[model samples]
Target chain A: MVEQSEQYLLTAYRETGNLQLLGRLYEPYMPLVYGLCFKYYKDEAKSEDAVMQIFESLVAKLRVHEVSNFKSWLYTLARNHCLMDLRTESRVSTVDIEEHLVESDRLLHQQYEEPITEERLALMESCLEELNEEQQRCIRLFYLEQKCYKDVAAITGYDLNKVKSYIQNGKRNLKICMERKQE
Target chain B: MNNNYLIIRIQRYLNGELSREEMYELEREALDDPLLQDAIDGYRLQQRVSHRQLSLLQQRLADRITQQTKERHAFYFGWQRLGVAATACVLMVLVLVLLWMRNHPDPQRGEKEVQVELAVPQAVGIQALPITGMAFDAEPAQGWKAFNAYLAEHMGNELPKGEVLLAFTIDEQGRPAAIRDTEGAVAELLAEAKRLLDNGPTWKGNTGKIKLIFR
Candidate 1:
């Protein structure tokens, strides 16, 4: 039903130049666009701006492109737009470097690659509970449900940066809590 | 290995930004490293938001577009109203012209005859007048006051007040033969007065063409 309505709106907009139809067609996917922007820009304001900018471009772009799956197409377009925006800004963060280094060293030295036992999984669950509410939610959605940051942001109504932070902090806290139990 | 570079690579891999070879290497490393797998899991969570946000954004965009459409519609409607008003004014002028033509047929011809009669009212006289010519009685013998009162009642506020001079003849049947020599407001008053007199009492004699002045 939704797809048919979207198709009708698309055709109507193309024929009539009615932006209202276009707006209706695009309305269902705004949060996804916002989430994608949030992921790329990691700033609430920038993400919101990106969502609006993407829509502006879509006015002309949709006319040219034969989009079969609007959701996936929109997702890719939004991601690429954000990537281009980030590239133009040239402002990559350096904070992830030290943490990545420590993680890499730990991975290389660890010998036993045992599957997580039921006991350890239980311990992990308890540790997960120990984290703050946002962190626990983000970490569970990301790790247990295998959802991406954008999805987590959409689900939780969290800003992209906040979702990422919660997950990262949650992971660290869970690790510390489990290690302490082992000791 | 520069773990910062490794982490960046992992991030890129999670974002699908990595090439095939880089992705393979990252996948291989993550297989054995539980912590690295956990990081990948955490990164993957970025893709799992609900569908509700799209609806919200759509509503906002629709509202903006709706507002714009309304403004354009209002502007167009304003111009449309002006066009309609202009058309009505032109139509009213045309109707007035048509009505005036119907009321005063062949005005130029009437004016020319009246001018000739005014130039020689005495010489042309009542005997020379055409039998078919119609005129108003300038002076009625009996009940003249009653006639005036009737004229006032019928003509209402539109009746021409003040003195009027008219040139006309009476027929053998005591009816007006012709009306002549008048212009402007007097012409209009005389035309109206002629209708009232024609419908009223008849005069007695074949009176010659006479100029009658009334106050």
Candidate 2:
């Protein structure tokens, strides 16, 4: 739905060669791009500069590239541009963010609207209990009780970072256990 | 959801705008999307993205587009103006040439033939000289006939025997003032030609040259 408008703008810009149309298309993603750049550069000024630079590149790139998924394509473009820039500066250490993010296989790509069966629910409950005490507490509070990470940390008397890790580890363990049970 | 709405949610989440349901919703979705998860982690480290900076960047983009358009328009119109000026110059020259042609036709293309029968003497020893005037280059002078009659009437028996070219300009008083022999005629012939022209009839306003042939 929203993607249709983005595609319309892209088509309009390509046909008319209108920069304003491209600007309108790119404007909505500026914040996301800025945030991604901030993650890499870690400096407000540099990140802002990178955002504008990415936009400058996109003006030329979008014309030639067959971009079907604009959001993900732009994300990949921003990330690779930042990574290459860092590599040119010999700062390989900054690319250490990969492990902190979800690995490809661990991501649950299932649709949110998919129905949950009783068998899966029971399996998930059993997997939930197998986690260690802190993981269980953080996961239950953060997800089941609808508490934010900070609130879960405060309620559970753990460090905020500790609470985040516990919930992450707990979710990974739950997925592992659920897969094992299904097999 | 709209991209702006999603960005606002991300900002609120980072700022701990504790709409717990929204937080849960964002977290649940982030589970399936690695890009969103990474962005969330990045936002956590960076804190927040200011709307002010985003707007400033947008304004800069808009200004760049407008400035490029203005330069293109200026370039296109600059050539157009030069073309218009060149055409106007050509038109004005054409009109002046037309007006000039109407005021002065082709000067009869050749010299006007002076009536020699009136000026030349019919005597056996002396013959009348043809009088030529310079005014025929632009406008034919009306006083050439009168001047020819004056030259014929003033012919004394002691006429010079060679050609004497006299150049003179008409003075403000409507009379020839600077009458001088240009061809270095003999002293007597130069004096006689000068006398004949200095006392010749007045022209309203004309500078003329008349060649005198004495027989």
Candidate 3:
């Protein structure tokens, strides 16, 4: 038999108020939630606590909020919860620059949908040139050469995080540049 | 892909175990999915997620769900269980009362039974014969009350229906001896009276005359 999807479990939990169904829906995402929490608190114990707390909040919040996409909604919830905790503790942690670089997947989805015509390809190539030197090089190594992020970081003599950030920023800039060219 | 596979792939990516193509594919996917991207970043910072800790958390979640179910069952059926217990108690008391009533008849009925016994002798009249009363001519060595009781007990219900006079003297052991029937009672009656006085309780040494009337 096909395993019940998270969507099915969510709907079942909502209708029946069965906590088991909700637990089933929430359990799979615990690792990701824990990781996300770690990004903020940077402590394993606090991150674990936040993962459980996020599930607890969802028990009530999911009832009130109409979630179109559970995964995105849950991520937003986890991030906001971590931020609120930090705010209460009167501590400051730097917000990730990658967060602002890619706000949504609309550009990526559009790019993937449109056929790679010569004009589109030419525009994307020009947009690639507009990125900073580091981003341009990382993006080309990762996308064009089909190199992994590790190989890209090794070749560029940059930190893994730095390489990932550069490529992410490069992809967003390239998409924005392509959109501007089209307009 | 399933959650486990995705997590394992992320772990492989972090551990540098994924091949170049696989790593590129995961990186490309993470670009479009911020959740996955942040998770990859979180896993990178943490180094790795302990399977043991995650399973422990899952166990805690399962326990919470089970605990809620137990509380609900107690809340919903608790009153029903109490009601059944109360009904059983009432039924048990009722049965005990019924059994008690069966074992003991009414007090008024017991009194009625005694009245019936009293009425039967009167209705016959033949069994109404009475042995009036007895008198002592002189006080014996033993008390007159005791002597009368001894005589009545020894006689049982076979008291002769006549008056008999007897004379006797107490011996050294306080026994009545040398008995004679002064009224010339029947030989059998005299012999019986003699035997009763001889075996009766000891009295003070004295001359004693006794009379008994039975009618």
Q: lDDT for each of the candidates?
A: 0.61, 0.73, 0.76
Query: Where in model 3 is the C-alpha error above 4 Å?
Result: A1-4, A97-112, B73-215
DockQ of each: 0.09, 0.28, 0.33
For model 3, residues A63-85, the per-residue Cα lDDT tens digits are: 66666568777877888898889
Candidate 3 chain B — worst ten consecutive residues by lDDT sum?
B123-132
Error of 2 at A124 (Å): 2.6
Task: Output per-candidate TM-scores for chain A, rounded to 2 decimals.
Answer: 0.50, 0.78, 0.86
**In candidate 3, what are the lDDT values of residues B84-104, reduced to their tens digit?**
999999999999999998899
Task: Give the Å error, residue B94, model 1.
Answer: 32
Which prediction has more favorable TM-score, 2 or 3?
3
Indicate the TM-score of model 1: 0.31
Query: On TM-score, who's better, 1 or 2?
Result: 2
DockQ of structure 2: 0.28
- lDDT for B213 in candidate 3 is 51
Candidate 2 collision pairs: B120-B128, B121-B128
- lDDT at B53, model 2: 78
**Candidate 1, which segments miss by more than 4 Å at Cα?**
A93-183, B1-59, B70-215
Root-mean-square deviation per candidate: 21.0, 16.6, 17.8
